[model samples]
Target: MAVSALVHLVTGGLVVGGALLIVLGWETIVQPVLGLFLIFLAAELRPRFGKVDEERLLRRAGVPRLFALLDDIAEAVGTRGFDAVRLTQDFAISAVPFGLRRRRLDIGLALWETLTPQQRIACPARARGHFAAGDVRHNLMVRTALPP
Candidate 1:
């Protein structure tokens, strides 16, 4: 993670620095165009971090029992409960950190149907465990640095 961060920082710095140099160089026929291109490239390489949108991909899990279960699991794991619980048609479970201190959880309806009650609980609990263990933040940092 540290190495990836360092690489990202160095690469991003070089890109921006090159753009600055091009813009600061004495006027020339091609300098403005080249400087603009370099500036755009720098912007593309920069990391962007933002909260995940919850309204578009899935609907919030409104079932009272499910919310209670999630709360219990969150308490057991010693982390704040998820900000939103979403249901989807896919076959996976995932959790993501949002703005500031919020986190969101998504459970696919297909996956939910396949799991036994115990397994259902275990799924999100495992996801929450990743957050509690700080894996989520670490992964986010690495991803932000690397982009695609």
Candidate 2:
């Protein structure tokens, strides 16, 4: 957390200083270019989750069968359960916690459709396991410190 804060502070300072140099009418093209680069870096410094989009989110009513399958998996895996479900075209399955009790599950349709039934079960189980394993890459603080 401290590292992320320090990084943000330094990046903010660079952005401000660069903008000031450009505002003051620097003698060379270097100042403007550097300013633009710093601004871009600031924009890409942290990844943010977008607003909830219902169209992409799977509702239990809309996919009760799929939800049932997940529930069975969750029970077997000994996890509480997922609160939200998202479908993605990318070939990946991941879960991220939000707001203490809620976990958002992102299911990649491409890989899902290609897997065998047994493999399909294993995929999500593995994703949940990754989170349970306490991987540093999954930490919010470390994630914020990384560039998008």
Candidate 3:
């Protein structure tokens, strides 16, 4: 009889202990852990979920300098005969080969937001052609990427 009572008491204690652990864990660990996980998930997804405007980008990067730089590039390449250059924060720049043998230099303004500083500075360095024709071609490519 005593052994049975001890067994029962031990079983009862274990049951109570398990219940307390569940309650304490839920309050102090599980709920807050899940909440923090959700916050981190939102932060990681924010960029893909967020919307960015071109004017806002230009304002952040200094509009006048960007315009003058584009202008200087146009004149340096002697492609001023092309249409008037317009500043925009729409499109990214990359170097591409246009000729049959892939030896010709062509800079592409990708169909996305404007050049990041690295691409903007590096693209012209990758270009080669008769300065005037190359400038005209480069501007045409950029214009084509723009909306109608």
Candidate 4:
């Protein structure tokens, strides 16, 4: 996925460069208009990067026990601790990268409400597995480069 993102970036760069050369080499109105269109295309393909708002998410300070469980899971999986834990309405758990090395874990309230304690542990364990496999970085790259 990182490779894909790099490819997209390079392609965007080439498009913009070629467009600029075309506009500069030719004085025609059509050439400048085409260059502007290519520039727009490059902007659209550029990755969208952002950080998760930890303030809005349920923090460990507010729910120590839950974070402790997550800590245990992280230890068991041999992965680093999560940056934050968030509650959501969806019936799924997700580990999302915020920036370079920051990862936030999102737990669905509906899923937590339905599952037993053991089952709840499994959710994050599986999410941690992605990190354990060392694919989180690539996953983040793909996610950032692609449009939803």
Candidate 5:
């Protein structure tokens, strides 16, 4: 099994075991109430489907050079390309994967415009690496399971 799945299993088991100990060891009336609350909390933690705004999708921009740079960077990182590019105001570049097979290359317009050609290529390259590596921080399930 994958290490990611194993981590989740261990975490889930620990939580459930702790809850069972609390329910079984405690003889107070609130024990059942706390158990029910834990159940509801667990139920609420199911990963939800992600939705992207179609309006933010980039069909084409006037900057051919930027697009070419993007193509080169993507090739360097071994990804086919982004399905869509989403412009953001956050001043950070990231790859956002939504649904099953769709990915959005999130470009922070403020930072993109300020970066040098080489820096622009570098930033996206790291984001691509994150997406490609199945990094824990980049996994939606892992992200959702942890507390913010």
Candidate 6:
């Protein structure tokens, strides 16, 4: 993604510079290089410039939404326990499974401030592991928790 962004920026600069050169009647090998740079830039950037289809899915679902989602997630897993969730960064979120069977969903600042010591330790591992694994689904769980 970073490469794509860099290419796009460089290519865009070259295209603009090339156009300006043309307008000034400055015909030189540089113009073609600039133009080619732009094409190459676009090609390199194309992959990163695509639309993000996961925005809705990535959204924090908020407290109410989380409640509903976690409720379902926990129930699905047959755990009476749930996890406390948080949005750790711009790109992803985290959650730590809790409860007997870990079927329940805790959310928001209020719940976060009230986690037990064990929950706090366990939460971050879950969230971080999920993020490292590139699983957006795990992002919904609490990766960190507050101390009791």
Report each candidate's C-alpha RMSD, comma-separated, in the order given. 3.1, 5.0, 22.6, 2.8, 5.4, 14.6
> Which stretch of 10 consecutive residues in model 2 shows the poorest summed lDDT?
45-54
Q: Pick the candidate with the highest lDDT.
A: 4
Best by TM-score: 4
lDDT (10s digit) by residue, model 5, range 56-98? 7874465566567767878888875666788899889998777
Candidate 2 C-alpha lDDT tens digits along 15-134:
787687678757888888888887777677634433466677887788898888877777777775676789899898888654434567898999889999899888877777756677
* Backbone clash numbers for all candidates listed: 0, 0, 2, 0, 0, 16
Error of 4 at 108 (Å): 1.0
lDDT tens digits, residue span 8-96, model 3: 45445555555555555575776555555544543442212112232323331355665456556656655431112223333533333
* lDDT for each residue of candidate 4 in 4-39, tens digit (9 for 90 to 100): 768677767868775886769576777777777777
- TM-scores vs. true structure, each candidate: 0.75, 0.59, 0.24, 0.79, 0.60, 0.26
TM match of model 2 to true structure? 0.59
Runs in model 4 deviating more than 4 A are 2-6, 50-55, 136-138
- On residues 67-142, what C-alpha lDDT tens digit does candidate 6 reach at each position? 5654554444444323334333232224443332231222344545667866754554454444345553332222
Tell me the TM-score of model 5.
0.60
List ranges where model 2 is wrong by over 4 Å.
8-52, 96-101
Ordered by lDDT, highest first, the candidates read 4, 2, 1, 5, 6, 3
Off by over 4 Å in 1: 11-15, 50-54, 57-65, 136-140
Ordered by TM-score, highest first, the candidates read 4, 1, 5, 2, 6, 3
Q: Once superposed on the true structure, which residue ranges of model 6 sit more than 4 Å away at CA?
A: 1-12, 25-43, 46-51, 54-148
lDDT of 1 by residue, 1-148 (tens): 8866786776677676667767676577476567677667767776656446545533235566767888899999988677777677889998866554557787888988999989988999998998889783536666566564
Q: What TM-score does candidate 3 get on C-alpha atoms?
A: 0.24
Candidate 3 global Cα RMSD: 22.6
TM-score of 4: 0.79
